[model samples]
Target: MSFSDAIKICFQKYMDFNGRAKRPEFWWFALFCVVVSLVLGMASSALSTLFSLATLLPSLAVGARRLHDTNRSGWLQLLWIIPLIGWIIMIVFLAQQGSSEDNQYGSTPAN
Candidate 1:
């Protein structure tokens, strides 16, 4: 998916955590978040903070969907707090190709 489309979908499903998300969708939105945060941070800390708060749920929801695409549980995101090893594991999982076939999460995310 393109960047704008990914952002749109993520916001639309900000409170949703039940489906799968393709690589492009997840990565593009992640990029958007980082870029926007950087720009906003440079402009004003308050705006950046507000933006982060606004995007937090969408980020989590999209992340959950990304994990679901890999046929893993969203709860696994908790591993992010465990420092280097955990972060590395999550990065590997998120970067790897998602399952092509359906599993417990749902059908494969559409490209």
Candidate 2:
């Protein structure tokens, strides 16, 4: 998906976590979040914090859907709670190619 499309879908589905999310959808939105956060942070910490807070739900939802695309459960997001290793592991899981065929999570996410 294109960057703007990904961002739109992510925000539209802000709290919807019961589906799949293609790599582009998740990654593009992630890039949006980071870029916006950095820009806002440079302007003002409060703006950055508010922006982060506003996007938190969508971030988690998209992340959950991304994991679902890989045939994993959303609860696995808890892995982020651990230290460096968990972060690395979660990154590996999220960055890896999603399941080619549908499994327990549902059909493969559309690009």
Candidate 3:
């Protein structure tokens, strides 16, 4: 998916954690979040903090969906608490291609 579309979908699904998100969708939205946060931070710390808080739910939801696409539980996100290895493992999992066929979470997202 294109960056704008991904970001739009993420906002539309804000607070929704029950589906699968394709790699592009997740990554593009992630990029949007990072860029916006950095830009806003440079302009005003308060604006950046507000922006981060506003986007946090959608970010987490999309991330959960990304994990679902990999046939993993959303709870796995908690592994980030473990430091470097956990962060790396999470990245690897998120980077993995979704199963072409359905697993437990749901059918593969349409390309």
Rank by TM-score, highest first: 2, 1, 3
| C-alpha TM-score for every candidate | 0.96, 0.97, 0.96
lDDT against the true structure, each candidate:
0.93, 0.94, 0.93
Model 3, poorest ten-residue lDDT window? 102-111
Q: For candidate 1, lDDT tens digit of each residue in 13-110?
A: 99999989999989999999999999999999999999999999999999999999998999999989999999999999899799999889899887
TM-score attained by model 2: 0.97
The alpha-carbon deviation from the true structure for residue 105 of candidate 1, after best TM-score superposition, in angstroms, is 0.8
- Which residue pairs collide in model 3, if any? none
Clashes of each: 0, 0, 0
lDDT-better candidate, 2 vs 3: 2
Top-lDDT candidate index: 2
Candidate 3 lDDT, tens digit per residue, 35-90?
A: 99999999999999999999989989999999999999999999889999999999
| TM-score (C-alpha, index-matched) for candidate 1 | 0.96
